[model samples]
Target: MSAVLDVVLSSAFLAAVLRVSTPYLLAAFGGLVAERAGVSNIALEGQMLSAACTGALVAGYSGSVALGALCGVGVATLLGLLLAALRLELGADVIIAGIGLNLLASGGTAYAVFTLLDDKGGTSGLKSGSLPAVPLPGIDSIPLLGDVISGQNMVTWLAFLTAPVIAWLFYRARFGFHLRAVGEMPDAAASVGIPVRRVQYTGLALSGALAGLAGVFLSMGYVSFFVRDMTAGRGFIALAAVFLGGLRPWGVFLAALGFGAAEALAVQLGTLDVPPQLVSTIPYAMTLVALAVYAWRRRRQAGVEVAASV
Candidate 1:
């Protein structure tokens, strides 16, 4: 017990939390953006998986990390546009279309990997390098703070910055106002001459880009190689964070951070005399509990509204 507490209290644990939370933060914000645009991007999982695979393969073959990251993000943005088109042009159900995209990404990435590398596992055989880490010279000299913040992956720094950037976008930007207005009432927004469809399309593209960044981080920043389904369920977990955070930027940031902390704790506990299986389940279990609490709060709010109306 004391040992566990010590581990949790250490600066290393804080750093681990930031590292683990990077993908979650990015993906959750992606979902939040799409949701605010009145489109639920359930294909976040697919986007992350596809991006991870694409980034690794591109980097490995081209020997250019920048180009690889660009291609990966481009692919995800295209997927987002694809989702928007399916919904807007074909009148297809967004949820169903997103699910289809997810499935397609899962199968498509795996096939691409096997076809190119002849490996069923992943791009482990490739020599793809990792993204550069940012070393804060002066900051690194600080005791606990330096230990926690210095020498993190560039993606990790971007992940932390995204929270504030998104907040500014949501409240202080013109596009954000349009996005919110369109989401709240498309008919009204259109009546006022706002291009509803265009805004939605843009929002979804941004969402995909953010998720793609998360995916790239997994393969190119978290490690030098990609694994099949390396995203594991981070996209879905990030979606949960979006809702659990009340669909707000800062709220989503905290929610994602909390999830990251849980996962980090689980990893730390694994080194202890704990059951590996039980420790691994901690993050998922927390997700379930969070969902349950959110649902109950929503139901209670609904009941209160009904009573007030009555």
Candidate 2:
């Protein structure tokens, strides 16, 4: 009885991990695109928050969850383009631009909620707004693996499916090569006829779109309404994932999964006889530890390479 219970319990935990990690995976992919093109996209928080509002408002009014999700992506793309214009073209500082965007999202969501929804702080009890889940056939009958791998939100599945594709695009494609070159050496890439500005603009735009989808997942799929600053600190956490994964798609995916597991565990443990405050910190604490491990390993590897060269 104990052995069977342990398997069941572990399976449940894995399912929770995958569900929680879905959002991080999307955000991490978005960040990866910009970073590979030499832009640090710290505005993920703002982009997601703004899109959440757009998705919730549109879905609530139009009664179409799909449309709301697309709208979220559209808004994110627009914001990304604006950031590109300021940072890549006008030479505005990326860090400052990110901060400004975050502020804009925080303020914009609140104002939109009040003005449009006639609500206080957020769009609570929103009606006719919900993203549907997708179910995988046959996979539901495979015991422990079944529940964890089947019947998830469309975006959740997309996040995983997109990982290998992103990896190939980054490492194997011509455009990927150009993006990497620009990041490593802008002057060298430009001299070779690559349009640095154009690449940066497109990269940032796509990053925004993916982040927007993440926002949609939060507002329409994860929950039924929009809340002010509901993205909380996920944007920053995704940034950590980028570094922790060493800018590699596979690494980042695993890192995102790790964070997701932490989140799932936190939620599960919260139901137990534990302090709410400590439980709340579980995900962030896990991220910090992961980051430290990544840094230490990277440094150790660098030392080994240096010794070999000597």
Candidate 3:
């Protein structure tokens, strides 16, 4: 128990939390954006998987990390637009379409890797380079502060910045007002000339871009290559964070951070005498508990609203 406390209290563990939570923060914000636009993007998993695979392959082949990241984000943005088209134009169920996209991404990425690299596992043979880490020179000299915040990957920095940027967008931007209005009541927003479909499309595109950044970080920042199904349901976990945070930017930020901390704790606990299996389940277990609490609160709020109406 003392050993565990020491690990938790260390700066290294705090740094690990930031690193592990990067994808969750980015993807959760993506989910939040789509949710606020009145369209649920169930394709977040697919987008992340696709972007990770695409980013790795592109960087490996083109030898330009910037180009690969851009292509990866572009591909994810297209997937977002496709999801919106399916929901809005074809009248397809967003959930079903999103599931279909997820399946396609799973199969498609594996097949591409197999066909291109002739490997079933991943792009281990390919020399896909990792994104650069930012080293804060002055801050890096500070003892504990440097240990916690100095040499993180660029995406980790972006992930932290995203929370504040999203808050500004949500509370202070004109588009945010339209997005929230459309999400709460689309028909009413349209009656007031809000260009409902356009806003939804843009929101979904932004959502995909954010998720794509997360995916790119998975392959490019987290590691140097892509692995099959490497996202490992992080996308869904991020979706949970969106609801867990009450679909607000800062709330989602904290929820995603908590998930990250849980995962980091699980990793640290592995070095202890703890069972590896139990430790690995920590993040998912927390997700279930969070969702249950959110559901209960929502139900209670609805009950209160009904009583008030009566």
Candidate 4:
């Protein structure tokens, strides 16, 4: 209990939670957009992994964060388009395509990194450039809040700001309407003369762009270099966040924060007297708990509806 309180009271722990959650937030948002558009984009893991390597490699060679991010987004989006083409045009199953893409990314990144820098591990040897960090000017003057809010990586701040923008886009914009229509009722949307495939493609592209940024943030902003499989299942966690949030943007944001806190707690606990094995299970335990609770509520709601109908 004291250890938990210590972590909660520590400013560094709060900051770690934000940092750990950043990739999840970005990836969850991407998954949310794609899922909302009915894409079932399980390939977010692959997309992020691919972008991490590409972003690191490009930034190392070019020495510019901007171009690195742009290239990363482009590569990841192309991968997304390819997945769409495979699933839509060639009749491939979405899950299969996603898994295949992940395998491809894992192998391809290893080979590319080895060829570029003779390292199968990652881009740690390369002089890769990182995205700039920015401090909130006035917020830094505050007491406890300043430590939590200020001096985050630029992409971290962007991820937070992007939530409202995406929400507004969904609630206000015509493109959002089209995407939602295509997602919710493809047959009806088609009947209305909406080119369903095109809209689906656009949705995936947007999702890919966001996932690419997450990858870029992982390598360029989070760590300043690429590592093999460094995403460490954050992509899958983002998918979990998508479901946990009921595909709502703000809901997913909160869920991501929870997972981040769990992760940060695990890190903190690792340094304490607790068993290492027990400490390592904290994050996964949190995931299981969240899912179990969600399942229970869903079943309860269905049972109530059936009872009322009877």
Candidate lDDT values, in order: 0.94, 0.86, 0.95, 0.88
- The Cα RMSD of model 3 versus the native structure comes to 0.9
Candidate 1 stretches greater than 4 Å from native: none
lDDT score of residue 64 within candidate 4: 80
Specify the poorest-scoring 10-residue window by lDDT in model 1.
223-232
Per-residue lDDT value at 203 in model 2: 89
Q: Alpha-carbon error at 65 in model 2, in Å?
A: 1.0
What residue runs in model 2 are displaced by over 4 Å at the alpha carbon?
1-8, 301-310
Q: Write the per-residue lDDT of candidate 4 for residues 87-134, one digit (tens) a residue.
A: 889989989999999899989999999998998899988888888888
* lDDT (Cα, 0-100) at 131 in candidate 2: 80
Which pairs of residues collide in model 1? none
Better of 2 and 3 by TM-score: 3
TM-score of each: 0.98, 0.93, 0.98, 0.96
Candidate whose lDDT is highest:
3
On the 0 to 100 scale, the lDDT of residue 27 in model 2 is 90
Angstrom error at residue 291, model 1: 0.4
Error of 3 at 275 (Å): 0.8
Ranking by TM-score: 1, 3, 4, 2
List the pairs of residues colliding in candidate 3: none
